[model samples]
Target: MNPVIPRLARLFLIAFAGVVALIVVVQIVWINPGKRCEEAGNWWDWRGRACARPVLISDITGRVIDTPEARAAAKDHAASQKAAASKAAPEAVKP
Candidate 1:
């Protein structure tokens, strides 16, 4: 009887721990979807209005859209990807 009780306790603890871990994972997946821009080696997920990171589809010379409808009509039709590349130009920073 003692052996059976110990085995049952162990099983119960394992199952409980699994449930808690699952909950945490679900929270993380749902919280952040698009984290590619914020951090490298990660992908973006724009689902259900959940964004793990922001997407800079265009250069950093635009306005900040703060509405729920984050659709940009200008960024998609741009011809200056090199503009953003020039942001790292050390020559311009000389004082």
Candidate 2:
């Protein structure tokens, strides 16, 4: 009865399981929108989003960078918002 090989295999399986569990917990707790409903106005707003089980989940890392197209879109969006804001406010009252 070779007990050593069996014990080593068991240990490896346990460590691998722990790592998997840790990753699952991180994704659920941090990145999953369903878990972060407190930051919203209504729960239904999350309906079509990733919380509806397994879509292309974004990175959990806080260092998420915009893709090239996304970056361009964001830049355009910000510029539009800035222009709107400037137009909405009267210029500095000539103080």
Best by TM-score: 2
lDDT against the true structure, each candidate: 0.63, 0.68
Measured by TM-score, how close is model 2 to the native structure?
0.36
User: How many residue pairs clash (N, CA or C atoms closer than 3 angstroms) in each of the candidate models, in the order given?
Assistant: 5, 0
Q: Which residue runs does candidate 2 get wrong by more than 4 Å?
A: 34-95
lDDT of 1 by residue, 25-50 (tens): 86666544434333654455646543
For candidate 2, the C-alpha RMSD (Å) to the true structure equals: 17.9
Those runs of model 1 whose alpha carbons end farther than 4 Å from true positions after fitting are: 32-95
Candidate 2 lDDT by residue in tens digits, 1-95? 79999999999999999999999986765556555653453342343544332232344445544689886887798799999899867865555
Candidate 1: worst 10 consecutive residues by lDDT? 33-42
Model 2 residue 40 lDDT score: 54
Report the CA-based lDDT of candidate 1 relative to the real structure: 0.63
